[model samples]
Target: MTRPETLQASSKPNYSSPDILRQFYQRLFPFRPLFQWLNHGPTPQPDFQNREFAFVLPGGAYIRYQSFLSADLFKKQCVQMTPERFEIGPQYSINPRDRKQLRKASSFRPVMKELVFDIDMTDYDSIRTCCSKAAICNKCWHFIIMAIKVVDTALREDFGFQHILWVYSGRRGAHAWISDKRAREMDDAKRKALAGYLVLAMSGEQGKKISIKRPLHPHVDRSLKVLNPYFQDEVLAEQDPWQSAEQAERLIRLLPDKDLTAALQKKWDSMPGRSSNQKWADIDAVAEAGHLSTLSAKQLVDVKQDIRLEYTYPRLDAEVSKKLNHLLKSPFVIHPGTGRVCVPIDTRHLDSFDPLGVPTVTALLQEIDEWESKSGNMSDEEKAKVQDWQKTSLKPYVEYFRGYVAGLLKEESKGKRSREEVAIEGLNGMEF
Candidate 1:
């Protein structure tokens, strides 16, 4: 097993040195298989370690990954860059028992594929503009994640895809990358549209409903050709220059905005002129170069099935269950799984505090204010009684709110568990 500190040291990217790469690879071997677990999608192995796959460092140096774990540990380890062997501390050394325990914890999870859509963290200007302090606008983030889940769930239910993986991008948003064999062939356009729709959908409005009649944005179709494999087939079938022009004309006519039409024309002008054969290439060139046609075919059917069946009950059931699990784990609620107690403010209390009750809290407050305004007519005795009523009446509501907040604190305490403790508990009967 690799020591955590040694693994951490390897993250300081020194690509010029073969010695460094070799050291990093050696440190990563024991945990290399963990990538399979990290990934929730069909773990497609690249034929060669490609430049497209490299880690983005804080200073903009992308070190190509010879191995994933060492590379991940390297980024995390290097963040604290120190001259000593163990910058994080002496406690960072590897433990055989800990590695065994990590393996045991991971084994309980089902095998699934992993996929990533890592937007460059260095692209902070654009990311901040869109994400806006990580506070989502409209329904974009919700829709994207929901779309990913819907696709994953539909594939599992309708297409017998048993495994799906989802994770946060570790920055602005989340990634619902899928690995199911069925999703490999989806054309870039369809996938892109689904993702766009998920991201740009209306929040808290009727438009949020996913329906069969959901129309694809025209721009989504054009960009789809750029990303998905399935759309390549449609592009490939339209080999004639005149036919392609007609499709483009039709797509332009469908655009709702004149400004968008101008933008499309500008983009079209810059695109390289394709040879008759090249124009028809259905898949991304890099993916094609890697002989990934079979994977694309499998992904397309699954993707279509996912979009079409988004409204089905089994899919809804899965989604609700996932939400319920999250809700249960929240500190606001009494988490049944962890036996955590919740704040006891039964919202039912708010139901009865109406304007009509005499000697009632709200009513009494109104009466006291009115009497004070007309104090010229009243004796001192009336003012004294009103003061006494105000103090006595409001105390219970204030106390209830304080105790309600206290109960929430208790629930949070019960749910809190260290990572190591969580790792051990997830192992069930497995021995480390």
Candidate 2:
């Protein structure tokens, strides 16, 4: 497979500088759609004001507990500061004016918040070998795709959540925002339970990394079903883990019987010239033979399942999902390292969503430059296209987001009418 283009080309202008970043935010950021997204639905408009906003500056300086009275105000502040990163908190506080009073008051309750999940590529360091840090290549991108499939499936099928939003983390990961009413109302403990249920691996310097008991639960089984295709095609064929002797030996150690391990090791030693794919084929044959002869069915199943889990299971920042107060990098903010917009991912066509393909701040500016260079006498259609985010690759993602918000608003309106009808019936009964 061909490798995707890198973001660090010589021709690309640096947008990390404060001046260019400020201009980009002022001239190009889609404030209208963002306002609609945050203030969605037919309920009280003050809900958007209670949501906390945070910013991360150029030199690693942090700002928190910031609130905006309106989307216009939020947009103005963003254009003025042009923060390198912007974050939104899951929990909404009662009062935006007095933070201390809001926290201290017993009457004030920490109410609704979207159940969020953060999946960072750095967490898969042990499994991937191509690139590390913020760098990503096509070979390593399968992990992200697998992560999305697993989580998306579980969230929709198991938890019965609709209106899920998936956003590409401008740098090396992705985030999921579940806006279903039931999900938003869940407390911290319930969120913690959900996070725990999704995670099967433990993190530490020592001991086994992944542990699952016998009689594997259906969730794990379903995840494996979702993960197996990518594991076989991408991890096995493309990654070629058996190329290194250390890695090969690790695979051999997972075999159930000593004789089968010895057989595989001898075969491996004899075939020093074999390709990685051929070596894997030999190991697979031996494992299959052992299953028929000495190994029990469970042993063979466990070995294969362990291999899949080791390579492709979702590695989550459990804290992000568990804590209500934790803030996540907001969508549409430019990542300092990559300069790409934190655009939403339309999971309907998830396979086509590429991080490398996201429009960078520099690129958007260049697009504007090109547009301005043209003759001033353009048609109405062309003018409209050039003015908004339609000129950039962010159009589709923003449209998808707008559609989701519209759906929520429709539901909210329906609920309001139902409540009004019930109230009218109660008044009539009182008169009688």
Candidate 3:
């Protein structure tokens, strides 16, 4: 397999090239496993066959309503068109291509899709002092890390969802795809309710006052507990969002009592250079020493908790999670801007995931060439055992995906059998 010319040793990687994209789709992209994941079994089903795919072509044309009968057909289209990226939408009731032929337009609709949540770094712009608008560093990435911890915990412990997949968006954000049968089967109303349950039901903008109930909701309590540790280390220390006196006012406004905020402001005013950590501490110190709080003790406590949540809670793109037909970028697609493959983030080792360290398309191709050269002494049988993805850094991610798909298929098989048993039992109960 000759490598694409774009991966030459001297030249820089150009992911936008159609030839390079073609090679990537033909070689590294994990279409079979992806198909098995969406199809929910080895064989084609409505989950995969009737699914809608939208592609962003190399020339920047966005084409939607594309459907494929099999994994091979999907791969063929990807390799032929060499799209910059493709998006996965819900499985329609009828084949997307045949929708126009249907007598009633209302009959053509999205049925099932994984409930997804998006956490963009842009959402954290006001809270994070490090970077803004599509730029992220390790220090700022803790926000994402904190988000995953809180949201993942809620999805599992609160909602009892079993299979959740988190993927780095190949740039300054991460996406969550919950693949539990119950999750996928939920309608738009249920999706909205679930998303609303997770995301704070308050104004998320900066310099605005955010309030929380006195007795915290169980979900909110758990999220707060999960976020408390990171508040000091991630937000107050690393982000230092209120380091400047001008910025400190944002924090001051959240306090319920005017006298308390004035005292806290006065303290922070004298020491403008105090870090966010110190300023946060000064809230308690000033409130106690000056006796300025008009709020009850519980109200003061709730106010502080609200302040903590304001800075640390996951700022999800709730709109993305509230719709069944909203298309999200496909896993393993190369982000044209970053040249990185959008790999799944293994929650088992969540804290250690380094988005910046993910493999790029050109580098993965180079790995294949290097491995072929290094294995000159190996027998044909030995070399044939390994897939191209196995020869590169992409092996672990693909293997993880394969394993996840296998588990899903097994559960889906069980679900089918259980439903069949119930139906047979109902027939036996019927009188002739």
Candidate achieving the largest lDDT: 3
Q: In candidate 1, residue 389 scores what lDDT? A: 26
What is the full ranking by lDDT, best candidate first? 3, 2, 1
Number of the top TM-score candidate = 3
Which residue runs does candidate 1 get wrong by more than 4 Å? 1-33, 37-52, 63-133, 136-149, 182-432
Q: Which stretches of candidate 2 lie over 4 Å from their true place?
A: 1-13, 42-44, 101-109, 202-209, 273-276, 287-294, 379-386
Which 10 residues in a row give candidate 3 its minimum summed lDDT?
Answer: 1-10
Cα RMSD (Å) per model?
23.2, 3.0, 4.3
Please write out the lDDT profile of model 1 over residues 1-432, one tens digit for every residue.
111111133443333233322332232111222222222112323211110122333244544322223335533433332111110100112221233455455432211112222222222222111233433332223223323434444444544534333322322233333333333333444344434432322112121223222254443333233324322222222222213443344333433334444554454456645332342232234233443333354443343332222211111112212210011111111111111111112223322222111122223334445656767776878666544223333334334433443443343234444555787778975867
- Ranking under TM-score, best-scoring first? 3, 2, 1
Per-residue lDDT of candidate 2, residues 143-230 (tens digit): 8989999999999999998778888988789999887778887888999999999987743322243456767888889888888888
Better by TM-score, candidate 2 or 1: 2
| TM-scores for candidates 1 onward, in order | 0.25, 0.89, 0.94
Candidate no. 3 TM-score: 0.94
Comparison by lDDT, 1 against 2, better one: 2
Candidate 2: TM-score?
A: 0.89
